[model samples]
Target: MSPTLVFGVIAAYFILLLVISYFTSRKADNNTFFTADKQSPWFLVAFGMVGATLSGVTFISVPGEVGNTNWTYLQFVMGNMVGYAVIALVLIPLFYRLKLVSIYEYLRDRFGQNSYLSGASFFLISQTIGASFRLFLAALVLQLAFFDAFGIPFYVTVLTNIALIWLYTFRGGIKTIVWTDTLQTTFLLLAVVVSIIMIINHLDLSVPQVFTVVTESDLSTIFEWDWRSGQNFFKTFLAGIFITIAMNGLDQNIMQKNLTISNTGDAQKNILWFSITFFIATVLFLSLGVLLYEYATTQGIALPGRSDELYPMLALNHFGAVAGIVFLLGIIAAAFSSADSALTALTTSFCVDILGLKRKEHKNQNRTRMLVHIGFTILMFFVIIIFSSLNDSSVVSAVFKVAGFTYGPLLGLFAFGLLSKRTVNDKFVPFVVILSPVISIILDYNSEAWLNGYKFGFEILIVNAAITCLGLFLLKGNGKNERLNEAENL
Candidate 1:
C-alpha cells in the first residue's frame, strides 16, 4: 500500500498498454481506427467485451452493494442474457446488413437528418457522463489510496488518468482497444479470482465451505417478488432486457467493437458468446461481495460510510500488499477497458453522425477524428470533477439511472424505425425524442403517490421508450422505407 509502490504499478501498466498500441497502430488509418478494418477475431471480441460491459462500475460498485441490495443485481444480469440474445438475432444482422460504422447513421437513413442527430446527440451525452463516472471512481481511488500520500491534488490524478488513456488510444482507436481489452479482461478476472482465494485463506475455509457460506447467507438473496419494490424480479428482468437493448444494442461504444468482425455470423457469435461469459463474471463479483462482507464482520472492521468505499478500505489497509495490488489492477483494468473504447466511439460518433466526416475527403478524416478524440478527453476530465462533487449514491445506480433517460430515446427511435412501415415527419423527430424522457421523469417522481406506493426502478427505461414511441406514432408520415432491409452495394 505504499504510495511509491502504487505509482510504480500504474506506470508499469501504462507502459504495457503503450507497447501494445505501438504494434497494433503502426499502419492504422481512419478505417483502422473506426472499424478495425473489419478483421477482428470473434473470440477475442467476446472475451474482451466482458471487461468493457462490466467496466469499473461493476468492478468496484457491484461487489460493495451486496450489503445493501444482496444478489438482486443477478436478476438484471439474467435480463441481460435475454437482451443480448435479441441483439444477436435481430440487431446484429441489421447492423451488418447495413454495413454501419456509427450505429446512429441508421437514424438518418430511416427517419431523416433530424432524427439522426438527435440519436447521436443522446449517445454523445450519455457516453460522456457514463465514461466520466467510471473513470472518476478509479481516479478517486488512486487519489485517496496513493496520490494523497504524495501531496498530489485530485485534479492532477484525474488529468494523469485521462492522459494515459489518450496516450494509447489516440492512434489505433478501436483496433488498439480490441487487443488491449482482451488483455485487461484477463487481468481483471484473475484479480477477482485471486482476491477470493486470498480472503478464503485468511478465513481458513475451503472452496466448498466458502461457497456454502456465501450462498446460504442473507447476502445471497437474489429475487424479490414484491411488485412495488424497485428490485422486484420482474422489474429487474425487464429493465435488464431494455437497458441492454439501449446500452449494448444501440450503443455506438459497444457496437463499435462488434462491427469490427468481418461478417454478420461472426459478429452474432461474438455477442452470444459475450452474453455467456458476462453472466459468469457477474456471479463471481457477487460471490466476492458476499465474502468481503463476511471477512469484514469476522475481523471486527468498521464499515465505510459509503458502500462503494468498503472494498477499497479493506483491500488496501487490512488485507496486505498482495490484496492491494490485486484490487488496483482489477479497477484500473476495468476503467480503461471501457473508457478507452468510449473515447474512440465518441470520436467516431461525432465525426460521422454530426460532422459528416465520411462525406469529406479521405485525407482529412483522420485529422478530425484525432481532434475530436482530444476534445472528448478534456471533456471527461471536467465532467469527472463535476461528478466527484455531486455523486452521493452508489455509482452503479447513478450510471443506470443516467442511461434510463439518455438511451431511452435511442430505443424508441430504432424500434419505431424497424417496426413500422410509415416514415416519421423528420423535422419533428428531435422534439419527440427530447420530450419522452422529460415525461418519464415526471411519472417516475410521482409513481409512488400516483400508483398506491409503487416505485419505479430500471423499468423507467421501458416507460421512457414507450412514451417516445407514442409521440413518434402520432407524427407518422406517408413515406415508406426501402433502404433498411437491403444491404447497400459497396
Candidate 2:
C-alpha cells in the first residue's frame, strides 16, 4: 500500500465524517450534544453501538488473539451478552427514570457529593485509558502503514488523529456521533467480511472447506476449564458480565449514547439488539483471525514478533491494494467511532459531573463545553503517547485490565447504592473507592500464591468492586439505611 493511498483513504473518511457532522449538528445546542435532543431512532443507535463497542481493540487485537487464546475470548463475550441484558433490564430504566445527563448523577442522589464525584472520576480514568488503548492500536498501524513512510513521528500522528475527532465532535457531540457511527459500523463489518473472504480465496478453500479448516484448526479452541488460567470459562465469563456492567452501564462513554434515545423502552430495545450485533461482529473477527494465520502459513510469511501486528501487516503489505484500502477504511472508522464519542463523553462528564455547568446557569454554557471538549481531546492525545511507551501486553487484554481496576469503584458504588440502602459517610466515599482498587491490586498480585493457586483475570473487577462495597458498608452513613434515592432527592 502506498503511503499516498493510505493518506487518501484517511482524508476521504474524515471528510465523510465532517459532512455527517455538518448535517447532524445543524441547530445543535447543549441538549443536542448531550442527548441528541432525545429523538434518536432506536435501531440506528443499536447498530452504531456495534462499532463503538468493538472499537480498534477488537478490530485488531481480538483477531490476533486467536493465535494464542483461540476462541476463549468468546467465553468472556458470552458473559458480555448477559451483562448487556443487565444493563438493559436494570440500569437503562434507572438512568432514564432519573432523566440523567451524566449517569454519575445517580450517585449524587443515591449517596452524596463524594460518591457521585468518585463514580465520575473513576469513569474518566477508566475510559481515558480504554479509549487510548483502542486508538493506540489504530495509530500504531497507521504509523507503520502511512506515517513512517514519510518519516513522521508517532506523537504527531496521535495528535493528528485526536484532532480529527475533535473537529467532528466539538459541536454536534452525540448527535453527530449517532449517525456517523452507523456509517463506521458498516465499514467495520465490511472490513471483516472482506478480509475473511479474501483469506479463504487465497487459501482456495470453499465455504465448507473454510469452515472445516477453522473448526479443525487447533487455534479455534474456544473454552478453557483450567481455573488457574486467566481465560478460564468461569473467570472470563464472570469478568465479562461485571466488566460490561461496569464499563457500559456505569461509564458515561457508552450510556451517553444510549441516553440519546427518546425513552427507556427505546433505549432498552436498542441494547437488546446491540448485544446480538456485537456478538456476531466479534465472531466474524475471530474467524478472520483463523483465516489470517492460515493465509500466512500457506504463503510462507513470517509472523510478526507480536500477534497484534499480524492483521495490519497482512492487510496493508501482503493482501494487495483492495484489502489494504479496506483495512485503512475499517481501522480509521474504528478509531474515530470510539475515540470521538469518548472525547464527547469525557467532556460531558467533566462539564456535568465536575464543573456543574449544566446544573447552574452560566453566561456561556456552549463556550464552557467547547473548552472542556478540547481539554479532553488534548488529554487523550497525551494518554495515547503514554500508552505507546508503556503498553507491553496484548491491547485487548490491556484494555480489559484497565477496566478491571478503574471501573471497579463505579461498579461497587452503584451496586451498593442500588442493592443496599446503607448510606456511607459521603465525604469518605472517595477514600473507600480509592482503597478498594489498591486492596484488589494487592490481592490480585498474590492471588495465585495466596489463594491456593487461584489466578485473577478480568474477574479482578469483581474483587475491586466488592472491596469498595465493603468499605462503604463499614462507613454506614449517618445511621440511615434506605433505598436508591428518589427524584425528590435530586
Using lDDT as the measure, which candidate wins? 1
Q: TM-score for all predictions?
A: 0.98, 0.97
Report clash pairs, candidate 1: none
- In order, candidate lDDTs are 0.91, 0.89
The collision pairs in model 2 are 423-477
Q: Which portions of model 2 show Cα errors greater than 4 Å?
A: 359-363, 481-484, 487-490
- Model 1 C-alpha lDDT per residue in residues 150-263, reported as the tens digit of each score: 898999999999999999999888999999999899888988998898899899999799979998999999999999999999999999999999999999999999999999
Lowest-sum lDDT 10-residue window in model 1: 481-490
Off by over 4 Å in 1: 359-361, 481-490
**What value does the lDDT take at residue 319 in candidate 1?**
79
Global lDDT of model 1: 0.91
Measured by TM-score, how close is model 1 to the native structure? Answer: 0.98
